[model samples]
Target: MIKFFRNIRQRLLTENKFSKYLIYAIGEIVLVVFGILIALQINTWNDERKAQKVEDNFFYDVLLDLKKDNANLNYYKKFHTKRITYLDTLLTYVRNPNKTMGIKKFGMYTEPLFYTVAPTSYETTFESAKSMGEFNNFKEKQLVKDLSQYYADFVQLENSFSSITRFVENQFEPLMYKLPEGYMSEDTGMLVINEEDVQEFYNKVASIKDNRKITYDYEIILKTPNTENYLIGDMGRSYTALGKIITRQEVLTKLERALNKTIKR
Candidate 1:
């Protein structure tokens, strides 16, 4: 192509047709400029296509994370719901002057209170995208906003769990340790038995103590100051955590729907 253009210029120059040569020269310049613009346009299109692909992959990963988060939150919801039931039972027994509960049953109910699971979040894709400034380039601004809000809500849920965990550690566990019947082992510094699995716990304890029975009157626990108040507070916290889990599930559903629409587009 270059050789053909060169020959045409040489022939025009040799022919001494100055005016025609000038017109041809202008046309060649215009052709060169047009070709450069087309090349640039093609390059721009390729870059945009690559960027769209990256955004798609990011959205796909985020969807997977949201699914995992929903499942985890569901488990937490069930757990808190069950814990609230135990707390309600304990509170009822303590509140009534005539009601009484056995030590074994008390242990079982209170045992669940001491354990807690923090709300889990799967934000790896979001975090990575944010750190790399990928979100700035994202075409779906609403989706990006929704993702930010969702993760922010996750942090709040975690704070809710932390409140209950702190209460158990700082207040509830110490009060329980002060109760009768040696709940903690003097040997290994561990709970002597598992309240949830009473049969297995009894068997293990019996093997160690030649069929000895662990006994403590529930009345002693009931008489302890602030015991009723602690149960109330714990129940409230459990309810709060459950509410957060429920709210998060709603947010997850909305985010998931948005993501599905974006991905389809």
Candidate 2:
């Protein structure tokens, strides 16, 4: 194609038709410029396609992370709900002067209270994307806003758990320890052992046959300074954690929907 154009130009120059040559020269320049523009447009299209692919992959990984987060939130919600129920039971037993309870049964209820399930979040994908500035590539402004808010909620959720943990360590656990020996036992079905360690745990518990030595005295426990207060604190903290989890789930759902729309595009 270049040789053909060159020959035509050479013939026109030889014919000495200066006006026609000028017109032909302008036409060639216009053709070259048009071709360059088309090439540039194609290159731009390719770059955009590649960027879109990267964005798609990033969002897909984000979706997977969100799914994991949702599962974790569900688990925490259920766990906190059950904890609140146990705390309620303990509170009721302590509040009612007419009610009586045995230490063994009380131990079963109180054992689980000693443990705290801290909130867990899957933010690896988000952190990676942020560190690399992938978020800037996102075209949907609303999606970016939702994502920022969604991850921010994780911080609040963690703070809630920290409060619960501090209460357990500083007040609740110490007070419970002051109780009579065997008031709370390790074999009270509170420990969650892995499947592989289940048999070993059972063997250890079985070896300690005479574990229950103290009997529950409702009046004594009720009279113990701040026992009811600690129980109430525990319930309140658990309730707070539950509320955070619920809110997080809603935000997650919104983010997931935004991601679905962006990924489809």
User: What are the RMSDs of all candidates, in order?
Assistant: 4.5, 2.8
Q: Stretches of candidate 2 above 4 Å error?
A: 180-187, 190-203, 211-219
Model 2 residue 205 CA deviation (Å) reads 3.9
> Each model's C-alpha lDDT?
0.79, 0.78
Q: Write the per-residue lDDT of candidate 1 for residues 155-209, one digit (tens) a residue.
A: 7888899999999998888878766544422222122222243455444653554
The candidate that wins on lDDT is 1
lDDT of 2 by residue, 39-110 (tens): 999999998888788888888888999999999888888778888988888888887867776766776677
Worst 10 residues of 2 by lDDT: 190-199
| lDDT comparing candidate 2 with the true structure | 0.78
CA deviation > 4 Å runs, candidate 1: 180-207, 210-214, 223-225
Q: Each model's TM-score, in the order given? A: 0.84, 0.89
CA lDDT of 205 in candidate 2? Answer: 58
